[model samples]
Target: MPSQKLSTLEKVGFGAGDMALNVVISSMMLLITFFYTDIYGLKTTDLALLFVLVKVVGAIADLVMGQLTDRYTSKGGRYRPYLLWLAVPYGISVFFVFTTPDWQYSAKLIWAYSTYILMTVMTAGVGIPYISLVSALTNDPKERLSANGYRLFFAKIGAFMVTIIVPILAQKWGDGNPAVGYQAAMAVMAAMGIGLFLFCNFTTTERVVHVVEKQSLLAQLKVLLRNDQWLILCGVCVTGTVGYVVRGSVAIYYAKYYLGGDTETVAAFLSTGVIAAILSMVASTWITKFYCKVKLFRYTQIAVAAISAVIYFTVKPGDMALAFILYFLLSFVVDLHAPVFWSAIAETIDYGQVKTGKRVSGFAFGGISVCQKAGMAVAGGLVGILLSYFNYQPNLEQTQFALTGIALMFSVIPGFFHLVMGMLMFKYRISDDYYTEVKVQMRDSGYIAG
Candidate 1:
C-alpha cells in the first residue's frame, strides 16, 4: 500500500494548486460584479444574466472534465496532467476576463458574455482536476485534512493579494482609465497563476489510485443520488457558498460607499477579511486536533449569523473602526468550516463507494463544483437584482435606501443563508471514527490497496 504520510514539500505543492486556482476564484468572488459595473461598463441587470449564463457553461464544462479525468490517463496521472496542459490556457482566460475593449455598449456586452464564459470553461478545465487531485494524493484522512489546511491558507493568501494589489495596481496603471489599469494588473496576476500551477504540477505526486468503475452518465448520477452524506454536503455547499459569495460580492461597495473609505481603505478592508480567513485556516486545523470538526463546522456558521446581525444593527454608515472589527470577527468565524468541509468531500466519496459497492471519483468532485457554481449563480443573480432594486449607482453617492440595501446584502441577507447552511450540517453523520470504519471495510474488501 502507498504510504499515508505526505511530506511538507508535498503539502505546500498541493496548496499551490489552490493558490493558482484562486486567481479566478477570488476574482469572481471579490471583483467580477464590481468590475462589470464600474470598470467594464456593463449594467447591473446585464451583469446578473452574465454571471448566471457563464456559470451554467461552467457547470457543463465541469461535468465534461469529470468524465475526461475518469477515462483518460497519462504518465503524469489522471488529474495532474491537466494542470500542466491547462495552466497557460487558464491564465490567459483570467487576463481576458479582466480585459476591457473599446467598443459600443452592445458589442461590449457581447464581449462580456464571451470572455466570462470562456474563463468559466477554462476554470473548470483545471479546477475540477485540481480539486479531484486531493483524492489521488493520499488516502490518510488526517493527511488530507492537513494538506487542505495548507491549501485553504494559501488560497486566502491569493485572495489577500487580489484584494490588496488589484485596486492599487489598477489605480497606479490606469492613468485615470480603470479598464486599462485592471487589464494590466490582472495580467501580472495571471502570469503568477501560470507559474504557481507549473510549480504544483512538478512537485505533487498521485499516490492513491482508486479503481473507477465504468458507468454511464445516468448510472453515475444514480450512485450519487444514493449517497445521503454527499447530498447533505451538496446542500451545505450551495447554502454556504450563496452566503459567502453574497458577502464577498458586496464587500467592495460596502467599504467604498457605506464605510466612506478611500481606495486604500477599501483595499485594507477587503484584506482584513482575507487576513482573518487565512488565520481561520490555521485555527481550524489546530482546533480540529482537539475539538470535533463537525461540531466546529456547525457552530461557527451559526456564530457568523449572529455576528452578521450584530454588524447590521450596530455599525452605522461611516463607522469604519467598528465595521472593521466586526467584519473581521464575522469573516474569521464564517470560514472555520472550510478545511473541514473540503476534507469531508473525500471521506464522503469513500463512504459512497462502501455503500454503493462502486466508486464515482471525478464526477463526484465535479458535482460539488457544480453545486458551488450553482450557489454563485444564485448569489450573483440576487446581487444584481438587489443592487438594481436598491437603486445602486456606480461611482456615485447613493441614497439612504440604497445604502441600507447594500448593508442588508452584506450582512443580513448572506447571514440568513449561512444560518441555513449550519442547520443543514446537523444531518451530516460522518465523524472521523465512522470514516475509519468505512476505510477498514474498503481495505478488507480489496476495493483499495492494503
Candidate 2:
C-alpha cells in the first residue's frame, strides 16, 4: 500500500478548490442574516427559522452526499463528479440567495427560504465529500496538514477580502439604500458562487478511491457512531461551531448597538476583524507543528474567550476606536483556530480508523459537518429569536435591553462556547504520535494512499 502518485499541480488544484469553497460559503453566512433583517425586509424570527430549516436540509444533504461520494468512481474520482455536476446549481442558488424581489412578504419568505435551503443543501453535498477526500488525496499526515493549512490560508484571504468588499458591494449595488444593498449583495454573492464552482472545477482532483464503495449507509453510520474518537472530536466541533456562529451573527448588532456605529463603519469594523483572522492562519500553521492541534485549539479558544470578556466590559459609547481594536484581537483568535479545527478533523479520521479497526473518514467528517451546521442553525435561530425577543428594531437604534443582548451575544455566548469546546478538546486523545501510529498501521493493513 505504497502511496499512489500524482503531479504536484493536481494537489494544488484540489487545495485551491477547498479554499474557494470556504471563502464564498463562509462570507455568505457572515453577511446573509444582516441582509434579511435589513435589506430584504424579512423579520428576524422568520429569517432565523428559515436558516434553521435550511440547516436541517443541509444536514440531510451531507449525509446523502457522503454515501454517494463514498461510492463515487469517475475519471476525476468520487469527488470530482459532484464538483462538476453541482457546480451550476451551487452558483445559481447563491445568485438567487441575494436577489431581491417585488413580491409580498409571504412570497419573499417562500423564495428566500427555498433558495437558502437549496444553497445549504447543495453546499453541504459538495463540501462534505470534497473535504473527506483530502485524506484520500494524500496519506502523508503532514501533507494533509499542509493541504488544510494552505486551504485555510486562502480561505481567510477570501473571507477577509469578502468582508472588506461585501459592504462596498452592498453600497454600490444598493445605491445607498438598504433595499438596494440587499439586491446588490445577492448579485455579488452569486458571482462569488460562480467563482467557487469554476475554481474547484479547474483546480482540484481526487487521487485515492473508496474501496468499500458498496458499504451501505446504515453500515457506515453504525461504525461511525461507534467510534469514540469521532464522538470526542464532535464535542469540540459542535461547541466551536456555535462559537463561530454566535460571533458572526452578533457582529451586526455589536457594531450597531455597542459601538453605535453606522452600517458602513460596522462593516469596516468587520473587515478589520477579518484582517485579524487572516493573520491567524500563519500562526496556526506553525502552532500545529509544535503543539498538539487539540491543545492549540484549547489555548486559542480560551484566548478568544478572554478577549470577548474584555470587550463585554470595556466597550463604551464614543469609544468606537477602542472597541474595534478589541474585536480585531478577538477575530485573531477566531482566525487562529481556523486551521486547528480542520487539521483536527484530519487527525480524527485516523483516530476513528485506529479505534474502530475500520475507516470511514467520509462518514466521520460528514457527521462533524452535520454537527457544525446543527450548532449554527441553533445559534443563528436563537440569535434571531432573541433579537426579536428583545425587540430589536432594524430601522432605528436598539433599546437598552436589546443592546445588552447584542453585547452578550458577541462576548458571553461565544466566550462560553469556546470554553466548553476547550474542555472537550482536552478529552480528545488524538496526538501526532497517535495519528502517525494509526497511519502506519493503516498503510500496513492494506489501506490505499494517493
Q: Rate the local accuracy (lDDT) of all candidates.
A: 0.93, 0.73
Q: Model 1 residue 98 lDDT?
A: 94
Model 2: how far residue 279 lies from native, Å: 0.6
**Clashes in predicted model 2:** 5
Candidate 2 residue runs with Cα over 4 Å from true position: 1-12
TM-score of each: 0.99, 0.93
Worst 10 residues of 1 by lDDT: 441-450
Candidate 1 deviant stretches above 4 angstroms:
1-3
Candidate 1 lDDT by residue in tens digits, 21-131? 999999999998899998887899999988888889989999999999988889999999999999999999999989898999999999889889888999999999999
Compose the digit string of candidate 2's lDDT tens values, residues 158-271.
Answer: 676666667777777666675667556656655665566566666655655534535677877888788777787777777887888878877866787778777688778888
How many residue pairs clash (N, CA or C atoms closer than 3 angstroms) in each of the candidate models, in the order given? 0, 5
